[model samples]
Target chain A: MAQSADAKAYNAKVYVTLRPSVLDPAGTAVRSGLSHMGYDNVSKVRIGKYIEVELTAESEVAAKSQLDKICDQLLANPVIENYRIEILEAVAV
Target chain B: MAQSADAKAYNAKVYVTLRPSVLDPAGTAVRSGLSHMGYDNVSKVRIGKYIEVELTAESEVAAKSQLDKICDQLLANPVIENYRIEILEAVAV
Candidate 1:
């Protein structure tokens, strides 16, 4: 039997946080919920989303452009939040 | 009235994790660094990355396709980690 080929590999990390001046209703709600859930020791509660993606792209440039679009157009709120991206590695699939 | 109009708004969240079997040297180093930094109370420290992007798109479908390409191609490691995407909102730019 012959071996099949693999897809390209890449890694991206994204972080989201509420803007300094904007009130974070969601965070406040989570904290309150935690307190009600019996987690009395929980001093602070900030809720954020985390996503991981796997893809095959022709080059790093194309990959980055696509990643940036996702962050700006779908995954983050610019009005009240700030974010950053990190590239972990580029490896063969 | 002077209004130049706004650009479309989108948000994304990306999470990266080491494959269960692969040793996380980077994470280990950070944990060790924290211990040396006099934060001995910190335990089981895990490190990850986050990104925020802004863009303009014609429609939601196009936006989704672009976002998926970003995840599968750039933002995630398929071998060791799994990822998910969230769309916060679609507003006029």
Candidate 2:
């Protein structure tokens, strides 16, 4: 791709996980399913959402800050879930 | 927790992502939402599933093998989605 004068691209991998203290009904159902399938050793399972975001910004710092804001505002529920953001490779767009 | 004579605990973190060629409507929706929020620089976005599984096994290798099978059979749609598995810290149960 041709480089744009001001286009800086960054990829963010965001992980949203439920708090450990909360009950996970879906996870429990999956666990029960595993047990029924003879995987009785399986004990606990937790399900969460994973998001990959690609954006352009002026700098890596700017992309990271924006990703944090996005995660906080829309990607995750702060009251019951915790989100972690990892900045992947950045490239010029 | 008291140790069980034969219980070996392993945690698995799995990431499931759609193949690059596939269309991701959910991701596109999120991208549109971000653009509405003034993040015009945002380009590509992908949405995936994250799962955490805790199990008891004889060894890490055993747990990993089982996890691979689980991901293949239930956790991911192998035809369109790719999955990566990471074996987290193992502990005696």
After TM-score superposition, what is the CA distance of residue B86 in candidate 2 from its true location, in Å?
0.2
Top TM-score model: 2
Candidate 1, chain A: TM-score? Answer: 0.63
Give the fraction of reference interface contacts each candidate recovers. 0.04, 0.80
Runs of candidate 2 exceeding 4 Å displacement: A1-7, B1-7
Give one digit per residue, the lDDT tens place, for model 2 in A3-87. 3588577888999999988888998998898878778888889999999998877777877888888888888988899999988
Give the C-alpha miss distance for residue A91 in model 2, angstroms: 2.6
Error of 2 at A59 (Å): 1.9
Per-residue lDDT over B1-93 for candidate 1, one digit per residue giving the tens place of the 0 to 100 score: 112244345554444555657676665664465456543322333344433333344444554665565556555567766555555544555
Report model 2's interface C-alpha RMSD after superposition on the true interface residues.
4.5
Cα-based TM-score, every candidate: 0.41, 0.90
TM-score of chain B of each: 0.64, 0.89
